[model samples]
Target: MTNITLQYLTQEQVDQFYRDGYLRLPHFLSPDETEALLTRARQLLSDFSVEDHPLTKFTTGDDNHVGDDYFLTSGDKIRYFLEEEAIDKDGKLTRPKEKAVNKIGHGLHELDPAYRKVTLENPAIKGVARDLRFHHDPVALQSMVICKQQHIGGEVPEHNDSTFLYTDPPSALGFWIPLEKCTAENGALSFLPGSHLTAPITKRFVRLPQGGTGFEELIPPGQAPAHPEGKYTLEACEPGDLVLIHGSVLHKSEKNRSPATRFAYTFHMIESAPHAVYDAKNWLQPTPALPFSRVLDDGPNASVHPAAGRV
Candidate 1:
């Protein structure tokens, strides 16, 4: 009989993620697990299609992330995403569903062992029509998985994440999980290794393609791509590996020229403490299920709710 111990992240790996603003861990998901998730992704997409009113108006990334596709709170775009996935109908996610969604939005942080993540068609998610401008999570940790890859000219253009949640230095991190083999030829995520160390810059706008509504191209809707000045790395990874990155890390991928379309999910996790970015006042009570596992500060009253005002 043979015995094997499950391997956890090493000190060096954790250090690297901090030093480089990102880290690539191979076999984070077993090959079998990756394949299973891919199969599930296809099923989810098909379920939406079965309704004849797919989540979006169009096919691919171009269809999703558009208004009338899902309803959201005035300022809670992330809540809108969860609604799109859980609800049955498309128009203005109703009160009943919104209530359920609000639970996910407000309480998702405390949900431990949280596997909740969002999907993107790359083309739609990174397109001008979808409002996927650049932004970072205010909390800590988040991730993405590829359900389908884009073969078309819609690659994730270069930009930094700074538009989503609000936090300094970005305590949140992103995970790029590939259900399919991700190679340089297939428009893999290209990152600016250590850019997360500095302050995040204000995103500029990019020009839109034809039939343009002046949507975002790089980070902001209605903007041009921003290029970072530093060393860049386009990781060559297999289906089972996941790329964990700092929220401030500059990342972007080119248009997929290969025949295969890219499909994946992305999520961001919020941390309670400071990494590089600093902003303790804005920290939510404490979301137990941020995208990654983070260190917690121990204190006499650590067990008390963060918002209870119990120091």
Candidate 2:
């Protein structure tokens, strides 16, 4: 008999996710919760100083190196990066702090109390992970608040999360939630349904031990696997909507041209199994390879596996 405790999503929802490679939950957060997040986001934006902020353009179009000191040192701390295009010829911010930032990230779930209370630390998250039936226990990997700045929000090219956080057999998933409304004008996500079924990871973003970063291709150049044509779908999201994206899905968002800002919080999870291996060169790993947050409690005799070293 199936255990009742493992049920978070209905069987239909689960089946739909596997079939389409994505799932949308409209009421993932309450209006009150959404408002709180929005307020917090605004405060963070307003308070963030631009005097020494690193201009980090948000890009996922092609495999690019991210070996700067700022990028390498930000995995465990709350830091802000500026929109690359928003800088003036003098290499300074062209707009105020409120409109110049690109993202605040890579650690909100573990460092921010507000985020942790509603996400990683929430029981529902673990329950959902259990229901997903991951190959091994799932652990929260990377967390960030995507600040889709008005008029300067950059485009995010189609790519899979596994390309950046790959496991030996490829196990990764995303949890994205908007704190404000997201629309086509403000760069909402557009996905190719069932893309995960056909699309294979093309390359990986890796970093050298000494310094620098680059792509490690898995397939021949220009011959990467692709999904079927004319299957594109765009989502118009409300403040509380949640999106679950599969690791192999092909998805992207356009540049925000609207005057409104589209802010969202997102994070990814991966399996921590003895057989799973994380490449030592991945760009976003914690420097010391700390144990990631576990989705399931370690029962009696539950021991940490070797794969836990990379998470």
Candidate 3:
């Protein structure tokens, strides 16, 4: 295994993160590494059989949230979700399977070699975690390759990562890497600057007692500060650029109406210290067979979990 020294963040950068709620680092991944992940994502999409799929469409809107058994149990398995606009009235895909799918998610960090390489084994990521003062071991989970397909991709509402992956102190941090150039036309992310410090997590996306999923209130609605529309700043990125998103930061992306597709790989990490409790009601959970991997537990190049046989 290769030995890697933890790279600490500069004081300026640290201050910026605390102030802005996000940091965009250019050229964080090599060209080869970026291409490898893109290729792997395409391969996964091609290999997935749409014939037997449950046609679960991923939605973050208040009315049609996905909470089926396939989606709930997908925390440990590789699963594909379709875009809401991709399915026709007759329950068939309007485009090819590759173009119709919205994302492949929730386990790539632990199951795929390509994803694991950039996630668990990446020295720079480990360094970032250390610099961020994650005193306890950070547990990485909810890996995903979001396919913002051309024309048919759906819009994502403004939300915080912690609302979905909640912990006691709200330590979820997102590492987002775009495989292709992201632009305003192709669904690049727009963030509400400094919202991490201002926006309190008042609701959580959780499994409902009746069996599906719903948002449970953490606090009364009127207490939290309102997120006004005009403050968002659009961030366009290229391949290899890394966007670090704070857990409480408010962010969202528009529909991909351009001719090009935007592919991005992302994963979240939460502190696993005894005090930072991971909520049991969170949609994504760890099982005995596929527990969340600690970021610093393995050596720089060591594999935290055996790669899945499929990829």
Candidate 4:
């Protein structure tokens, strides 16, 4: 929930973006900015702890919150994750504490400087880190993903950000930021070259049929795929470097057999617009299978919750 205005863009940067559809913005957030976001995220988790966290209904963890099977499939889990559970409304998690909030969930993204909205990833969510499954931001066409890997096998899958999500043409930007040092051993991202500039790629995705792994690959293979020049490997990055990507790009994460958790954060960006949630004009929306991030409209002086201005 950082309060940031889009003012740092330069002519050269814009040109690069036009050429590649994405550009890396290193050290965009100062240390203070990043820390402030971490604080806010921790605060939210603390509050969820105090209150009877109601979002537990949508989770079914097999290995603690590390690997959860949700009743809601296809859509992004955030929608169902945040929804008030009709059944287990009592926020008490049935799963062990190890699964409740994993250490990796601490990878917080430093959004606009104000640090207003922070994306929270529980162990259950990260445990499902099998594949991106090819989707995109709908209206805002922007999202941020952050994480820290404590296990040696935490990896991210690859796919076009908008392959099956939307077809309005690539106007979305994907930003990957690291909270901790990222190296090949720690699990960095690998991408395809000039793939983002090519026309939108669309094809029916048929899984292995027997459900090999939930979060394995973002793009489940269907028919033959165009051989987009797969010639890009993101350079290893330091603690504060960020990789900005185009929505049309094809990318995936590498192996992470390291002893410690690989900590990183990601954000999806779309041009500012109105009525963005469900409109087709935007192509980055999640596929028919994933849930969607609804359009949020808060009236004047609105606090995140209705409790604000209450007394």
Best by lDDT: 3
User: Candidate 1 — which residues are off by over 4 angstroms?
Assistant: 1-7, 50-145, 148-150, 199-228, 272-311
Off by over 4 Å in 3: 1-8, 228-230, 298-311
Q: How high is the lDDT of residue 148 in model 4?
A: 33
Q: Write the per-residue lDDT of candidate 3 for residues 127-223, one digit (tens) a residue.
A: 8876655335778978999999999878989999888888887778899999999999999999998777667888888999889999988878787
Cα deviation of 226, candidate 4, in Å: 2.4
Please give, for residues 1-311, the per-residue lDDT of candidate 4 as tens digits: 53323334554654565455455667755676556655544444344442433343222122122122331121232211321122234545444332233222211222233322432222211111111111222223334333333342334456665442333333344556666667777677777766665635453122223432122233455644556765767657665565666667777766456765454556553322231223432222345543333222222111111111000
Ten contiguous residues minimizing lDDT sum, candidate 3: 302-311
Local error of candidate 3 at residue 88 (angstroms): 0.6
- Cα error, candidate 1, residue 207 (Å): 21
lDDT of 1 by residue, 1-311 (tens): 22212135554664576667677778766666567666655544433322333233211133232233232211122222222233445454233321212112222222312233222222211221111112211232433233323433244545555433334433344656766777777777888887775535443222223322122323354343344477778887777676775656778777566776455445554434432343323222233333333322112111221111100
Runs in model 2 deviating more than 4 A are: 1-6, 61-65, 287-290, 298-311
For each candidate, the alpha-carbon lDDT, in order, equals 0.42, 0.76, 0.84, 0.41
lDDT of 2 by residue, 1-311 (tens): 33434357887777777778888888888898878877887888888766666676555545454467787767787788777678888887787877877788887787788887778777666666666664456778788889889998988887888888888777788999998889899999999987787777777778866676777888888786445675679988999888988888889889998999999999888877564777667777764654467656742112322221211
From the highest lDDT down, the ranking of the candidates is 3, 2, 1, 4
Error of 3 at 219 (Å): 1.2
Candidate 4 TM-score, C-alpha based: 0.53
Candidate 2 to truth, TM: 0.89
lDDT of 3: 0.84
- Cα misplacement distance, residue 188 of candidate 1 (Å): 0.6
